[model samples]
Target: MEEVLREIYCALDQVLRKGAYINIVFSGEFKHRSAVTFVVKGVVENYFSLKYALETLAPRGVKPALKPLLMAAMFMLKHGEIPGYAVVNETVAFAGKKFGSGVKGFVNAVLKKYPTLPEPEGIQKREAELNAPEFIIEALEKDGVDPKTVLRPPASDLVHFRLGRKGKTEDLSGLETLTRSEAGGWFSMPDTRLKELNASGKITFISPSSMECVNAFGDINGKKYLDVCAAPGGKSVYAAEKGAEVTAADLYPHRVKLIEAYADRMGVKLNALQNDALCRRQEWLNAFDCVAVDAPCMGLGVISYRPDVTINKRPGDVETIVPVQKAILSEAAEYVAPGGRLVYSTCSVLKAETEEVIKDFLKKHGDFSIYSYKNNTDFGRLIMPDGKWDGFFICVTEKKK
Candidate 1:
């Protein structure tokens, strides 16, 4: 148990020091003890507080390499009933194994000094914000959703049933059905239930909203379709089932391979290509009858499933993703043949990433207009992150003849 706890600490330390995504790290270290599991989650949930604490303890000149472990130790000192001496001994031992004896003394000193550290204003604000980063709180404030308290999941999944092409509704009775079948779609379901659902072969274990989004768009009857940035191919397969000739492209080679595998398993024909949509290559330029750009964002809307996002994500994440979103939207616009439609979507509720990005795209591309089908829908209709589905924004645009 102690060794597992040490590994968890080491993993967390590496994640915070390098700013690596914790999801990747957490998934890799899944066999740790339950106490270690709880500690990992607590450290991640309180990452900002942990970062702030490290900044306070370590000298600016010294690299705060063990920030996650230090932060976890501080959390224990401030909140847990663990003896201060034991915390220091264990954390220093962890540092010795990872960073060597050269850094052990520093680690020991910091843990010993953990309880004596001054209370930070950031911690108070975090507590007030229910452990979410201040930036998220600010963003949510703009949306009028006070995120000071936790929210509850809906009694049922976001959609009671998917709308079939002939208007038949396919009912999904269990939460696991949604996750296994549609993993890319984000939703918060219990882990035990998700495992059971996976074991049953109900859904392929992707996102929570996968089924809802695929079904909502209806099926394509083998018509030509383009999925821009479609590396993981969940939507592509769903479209193929409806008989669409799917062309999925992403900038990354690895992602293209992933899509190819998914297409193979789903028994769908897909032309998976490693091409940047932003470059507007002539081969793909204005060549599709339909295009889907699922632009990336800070993912503020799906915090329930990725509880760590609320703690680790910063305000700058939105700013960083905005240019990429705009570029994708701009490139997607050029790919829609005249009179054809291009769909712009994101699993984010932030105005800057969703409606605001769409507004800017419309401003830049004078030849396209809002398709009205998506524009006239209720403001909060499909984007109910606080309820069943994670917050999602979708807009359709048609190129002018």
Candidate 2:
């Protein structure tokens, strides 16, 4: 048990200190075990709340470097299956060995006091329960979305997969039929192993919303498609599956390989390359008939899939990303040939990232206009995260000839 806590703390520490993504941290380490995976994800899902608890529990205040370790211990005491007494004792011993004897007393005192306290009240009460920061709560209110609307259970038990071009619908027997998107062809199977099914090559695991973004391009049988910020390319691959000429690009080489591996697994072919979206590529300008700008944002919409989004996110991160989103959108728009179409999408419901960015871009560039589709307003489609579909904002626009 002590050793298990040690492993959790190590993973947590890396996420905090290095700003490493928590999902990548726990991908293979504790993924198989339900109990350990819960703790690993729980610590991140409730990270800020755990920090709020430490604020009231510790008098002298925890060292900044030691905070991740203590946060792991606190989360275990509150939510983990480990006995509280054991959590305290083992953490104390480990703290002494890891951080020295001085921290042992500090660690012991904090844990012993934690279990006796009443539940947090006021801001901390809400923070602990929702794992949402005060700023986010306030922001959501301003956006006219009830923060409770974002309240959702963790990832679904159903495995989402799409069939290859040669695959058959008859193979979908006994599986749950997914709600078809504007661009159809997606399904889910409950209580199945993703690794096993993906290995079979009968299906490629991809999300419906991902393909829906491609559908926004209308008909792209032989259209040149570029996903400027694409990596581990699901949308780009889907475009290729739909018979479009796909060119996927990411900023880094390693991520390009992810796209390569994804293409190899699904038995599809597409050009994958490393190129910065922020930099101007002379020959590529106005070349693609369709472009996909799935810009990086706060990712608040997909917290259930990536729990670390809001908790690790600082207040100013929302402001910092707007320019980047605009820059990529601007670059992607330029690549859209006259009379071509471009789709701007993100895994966020934030208006600043979704509506504001699109509006600003239109104001600067008159050649593009909001191309309307069913169920989508003039700005774009902002789909809230239901347990079934990810919270995503997709807007398809046309480059006027």
Candidate 3:
């Protein structure tokens, strides 16, 4: 158990201090893999609250290196299935070996008082409860979404995938359905079943909004579609499934392979290649009927599952990424044929990523106007982060002739 806590501590430290993605951190083998994941996620989901509780209980505060350790132990004491005494003794012993007797005594002292210490409440508690950063909360509030309404932390550990046109649903066992299923869509499965599902060569594991963005192009049975930032090609493959001749491009070679692998698994074919979205192609200009730009952002909306996103992101991330989003959008607009559709989507609910980017784009591109498909607003629809469905911003705009 202490060993698992150590693993959890390292994982949290990577995400919290070293700027590593949680998914990347846990890709390696751990003795108690599931337990490590469970505890790290719990700590991430309750990060601010844990910090608040720790600070309130241990006002003098431990050093920066010991903070993650203390938080891991504290989270385990409150929420772990293991008994509190075992948690304390294991953590104290681990701390003594790693951080000397001074820090070890501090860890033991604080943890013993944690169960009796009053939990921090109000705004900090609210922030912890939501597990959202301050910038995201302010951005959502600016966009008229009440942060209070979506304050619960994420709980599910489900993977989303879809069986293509050829695969029969009845053949697969333990397949659970989600809300949006337009492109032969979503089925929740355990991580164990992924290999079995993938070996069938008729599945693509993508986010809900990945398929949703492609569905936004109403009746795209014979359209020319381009996913400018397409990698791991979810939207691109979905577009091909719906009978649009697909051309998916990403900047990196390895990512293009991911798209090809995804397409191959689903028995779907598309022209996948490595090309930077920032650079304009003369042949591609005004070519595609539907151009989808799944622009990269800080990923605020999907933080429900990837809680490490909040920790890895800095205060200036939204600002830093917005220009890139705009640049990609501007480049993508040229690829859309006259009177064709331009669909912009992101795994973010921030106005800066959603409305603000579009606002700036529309101001520059007079030929394009707000478009509607499947009941979306002018800028796009910002789905709040909930455990059941991912929070995505999808806007479908059109180029006028």
Tens digits of lDDT, candidate 3, 1-401: 66787788888888777877787787778888888888888888788778788778877866888888888888988898889999999999998888887777778889999999765577776667667667667766887887754445455666667777666666465555433354345656465556566677656566666677888888888889999999878788888888999999999999999999888877888999999999989999899999999999877666665767765556778888999999999999999999999999988777888888999999999999988766456677766766756778888899998
RMSD of each: 5.1, 2.3, 3.2
Q: Against the true structure, what is each candidate's TM-score? A: 0.78, 0.92, 0.86
lDDT of 1 by residue, 1-401 (tens): 35765776767665566655666666664565555656766776666666656767776734556666677777776666677777777777877877788988888877777667776675454543356666666676776765542222233443322222222113234444343224233343455644444334333444445444444444457567888878677677667767878888888999899898876655557789898877877776777777888776676556555555555565588888888999988988777778777877777767777777877888999998776443434321236564455667777777897
Evaluated against the true structure, the overall lDDT of model 1 is: 0.65
lDDT of 3: 0.80
TM value for model 3: 0.86
lDDT score at residue 279, model 1, on the 0-100 scale? 86
Per-residue lDDT for 342 in model 3?
96
Residue 244 in model 1: lDDT: 77
Q: Mind giving the per-residue lDDT tens digits that candidate 2 earns over 202-319?
A: 6676666777788888899988999998897989888898889999999989999999988887778899999999999998889999999999888777776767766666788889
lDDT of each: 0.65, 0.80, 0.80
- Candidates ranked by lDDT: 3, 2, 1
